[model samples]
Target: MVYPREELYPREVFDPRDVVDPREELDPRGMVDPPKVVDPCNAVDPRGAFDPRSVVDQPKVVDWYNAVDPREGVGSRDVVDPREVFDPRDVVDPREELDPHGKMKVVIGRLQVVFSRAMLFTLGLVFAHSLVDAAVLSILITHLTAEWNEYSLWKAAIVVNVQEGTLAVAHIVFILLSDVWTGPYKMLLCSAAISALGLSLFQVENVVSFYGPLVLVTLSQAGIVVTLRPFFDDQVMSAAGQSTAETQHWTSIVWWKCITLLAAASAAFGLSRINPFGTRSLVSAIIMGSALFWFLLGTKFYSFDEATGSPLRDAAHVMYIAAVTKRNVEYPRTPNQLFQNSSGHVKIPPHVSWLRCLDKAAVVMPQDQEKPGHICTVEQVLGAKSLLKMLPIWMTFLTFSTVSATGSTFFLEEAASIDEDFNFLTFIFWQRLSSFVVTFACGWALEELGRKMKVEQRMILVRMGMGMGCCVACCVAAWINARHWRLVDSMTVSRLVPQYVLLGVMEGLSIEGLDNFFITQVPELTVRYGPAFEECVLGIGKFLTAICIYILTLLWRWFGEDVYSSRLDKYYLMLVVLSSLNLIIYCLVACWYGDWRFPIPAEDDDIETANHNPVDEAVQEILLQHEKDSLPLLEQKAGQDTQTLRSRSFTRPSSPMVAHRRFYSMRS
Candidate 1:
């Protein structure tokens, strides 16, 4: 079955050395060295031949050029030659930790290293997943009513809405429970299992079919958001190095890009007519199944542990709670229980090198550490005394809950008109292309803008932009009603594009940045909250929208259509005006926004100066014990050489671990 090796690459027929040489006299340092070409079997590849099993297919990538030493050269190694030294990474080693589970994992294939495939898959799954529902509403509902005589919007919404609500509550409960007692792996595994179960449930048929899987669908999404945030962030952080303060920043950018790409792909696939099976069943099955595969299975290799696995990292976080607060570790537990306390003063082991331990003690929280919180001093609250620690928590709730929430409203609002004249696929194009174009443009704008400003400034701008954008959207609606007041049919592509485009622009400006802000400001444990935060906002926004919609409904009934339509412009304008007002308030609030203790580096030089690991309170507690009680014990526990403190006890706490003595970071 294998094709002849000759067909793949004809080594005997081609010699790259003739075209390019590593030992070119013009070359200074040999980075441009041509790959060393050996005979068909690689008798002597100056770069050393990688084994066949190393690559996926063992691609017979023959070295196109052989390393040649010139008689007149200033010494072979002394002179840089491409043949002498081409980075052999192109020839991958399968044994070189190709598996995601490997302790030292390379960025899965090269492109994944560059773009993050795991996250790409996750984001794409969700983005594409929406298409199924959109179609369900667009086609299935229409078909059901016309053919089966069984379609009810209120019923359908109730089913989905209730299921979603139940799912959200269960998800929060699960997250809280897991945060305290479970390892990140356990939660991810459980989530994956639950997601699979939920998807399978969608296959069931009933009079309440769509409504039936509501709880399952909701739970599945919660699991995905909770698990995915850390899974993606960890990969990005490990590969990125010390300046990973904004690992989520990179994650958000990739996430948005993938959303755009998926939207584009869905547009391309648009309403398939391949077999015309039960459209509703097929759509539900696909969505649930994909969610299972992506949020649960495909990411088996990608989880939170790798990102936030170190004991040192966890201990530091727990210590942050202790160091800042005067309270003992006996505090009540929350959903996230990385926080712990110690009342007794246990002796510090003498052999421990406080400074050396302090060095590595600086590692960021592993991805598995979800919803990390900082123990802020009373002053850290920035005068929002009542809202200090609470702001981040409530804000996160508002953001994450909104993911699928606003989504429903937005898609519903856009029920796409289709003419029976054209083929089904053409209609798909309109919906998809437009959606993707909007998503992509927004991502691009945010990334481009992110690079220009300080992260703190960026944070403030995003919130203001988002609140204002919402207002703008409302206004746009108002304008649409105003300009075309008399003619309902007068609204054409031209008018629609302006409104749609503006909404899209606002989406780009606000959403990604808002997501990024949440991720950046919190500790590593709380990084998982990024998506949760965004989704919450969406949830809240949807609820708010729902309430508004209800109020609108009441107004419509009381005032009648003529009166309501007449006031539509006023309502829209009111939204715009309110948004402008909100923007002002948001900017003012953001002025007080500060960086997480560690934020992403702003420049190249920061790469080094930024923390490899810093000895913050978390580092101190995990590294050593209280000075008063532990000193005698620690002094006794000193090394055989009586020199460094690193040779001592690494055990459960029995003492107050002071900051400086805890981490030998000074020496580190």
Candidate 2:
């Protein structure tokens, strides 16, 4: 099928970079007129059997032979089209030329890399926090201080639970950072520094003075995570970080697993007499150093699309809000002419729906082709009041955050129980080995797990699994401290090992899907309320757990010390009951979540919403009107640099429809 030179590579007005020699791309028609768009990710065959149009577009490469629709057999209900999920514009079949399996090899390797790098950084924080709690929990549970282990499991749960709010608290603070205009890197650095300091003190202290430092560390961590959504791909949403585009929930699961596996290995196979507390402190130091290094260096690649905070972008949104309320003074200052021309950034009028504006040459702005004032306004309700329209979202957010925080705190003690003999590297080694095997199993069996389940139902099952693990943790502790529990005759090392691993598995399930659920329900409140909401739920759980423990203690008191020592399993069984209640509540909440309804496009709701950008209009207005009053603070913040430095802006994509349409596509 040789063609004239004109047909193979034509000279045209289209940018050469966009051009792909049809011979190289999937030019199925040697006889067809002008060449077509290319697919980069999928490398399908060039023969007439495939349409190639629906495939992704990308840099042209020559070669052909491969099945493109391999996913058809695997995809059932709710299965997402990876093409649309990754990007709509880049729909070329990257697997067209290469063998089908070859691309998968590359894709898997890429996934491992992407997954690992992100997982390591996030899990490091979880490990850091859990290490501290493990030391505290271990010491208290073992009654090592000559002081009575008077606290009930609920009280222990509360102390640890309060800090779980850190994840959400970080988010709330990050929204404020949007107003203050701080970046994710800075937020993360601060979080790490504070966490390290807190852990260091824990290494040299008793429980009486632990709360102050712990609170500081929790605040910093929550602010960083909440504001800076940890997912790397969606890091570049806005300069002020008002509108979130990416979610960092997956990191929670990955970290939870890492922490649990590490802790379990330490507990099951650690030195017979090593101090879990000291080892945790040492590990915390190492993680802090790594955090500082990444926050400084790796941050260049990060952007604030909810994964990080971007202040300038928030300023632009403020301008949008001001115009809506007819306040001209609050508009984003028009870039000074000198910088404007140099930066190639002209102010767009406020009424413009960014989704409907696409600036081709520029990296940002991809809604419509219109410029500035030409963009049109969307008439749908899109403010705080609108959020109330869907009352169930907040309810679910609260319910899930509460349970997730409880479950994660339950894991904290489990993670801190690493083998005394394992050094940091060895601990990490065992963690990697266990994680690799377990993660593979989960991936391989996810389809089967989801077969008869909705996302909500599956998640409840996950929570119950975690609850069972907590029961396992209590039983394991009782077995290890059997003499005190009056079970010295039956206590054995082997009995504890399985319990440790069981808890790890449970942590994997409970921690992994939590953030994904929260982000799904309340994306709009992310900037101002994301962390606040998360922290509030976590705090409530922790506080309640503390109260429950007190109640448990009173109940145990009535029965006498002999009763507690002889019937420790009773306490273990009680945890099972409590977790069961939470798991049931989660499933019920799932029933009420009608994701199918939303004025915002489906794509906008994604964990990586390519274009879901909604500013907190109420919050933005308050900040703008008060900016004059806060001028001193702004001045200290270096004069509010909402200006762009280069010919670039990290904008949020706005196709919520596309995101939602296929959200339930990848169903079992």
Best by lDDT: 1
Candidate 1 wrongly placed segments (more than 4 Å): 1-112, 115-171, 177-210, 233-256, 272-278, 283-407, 410-467, 470-474, 482-486, 489-499, 555-574, 592-668
lDDT against true structure, model 2: 0.38
Over 202-321, each residue of candidate 2 has an lDDT whose tens digit, in order, gives 554566665666566556555544433433223212111232222222222333445645654454344214555545555655656665665555444443443333333333342343
Number of the top TM-score candidate: 1
lDDT of prediction 1: 0.39
Question: In model 2, how large is the Cα lDDT of residue 79?
Answer: 54
lDDT (tens digit, per residue) of candidate 1 on 1-668: 65575576477876665555535655553434255322234333344456633432213233222323456544344556565466677666654443343323324432122334455455544553444433433233234332333533323333334444444445444554445556455665565555445445544445467444445545655654454444445544543434333333434444544554454345336545432425443554565466546655545445444222322223333344444432223322221112121211111111123211211211223321221232321111111121123253344333223322323322232232212222333333443444345444654454456556544435335643564555456455645655464456433333334443444345444554454454344333333443443444454544554455446546763112222233435445545565555556555556545433222222222112222223233543543332232111112344542211221122211111101111101000
Question: Which consecutive 10 residues in model 1 have the weakest lDDT in total?
Answer: 659-668
TM-score of each: 0.52, 0.47
Candidate 2 Cα RMSD (Å): 20.1
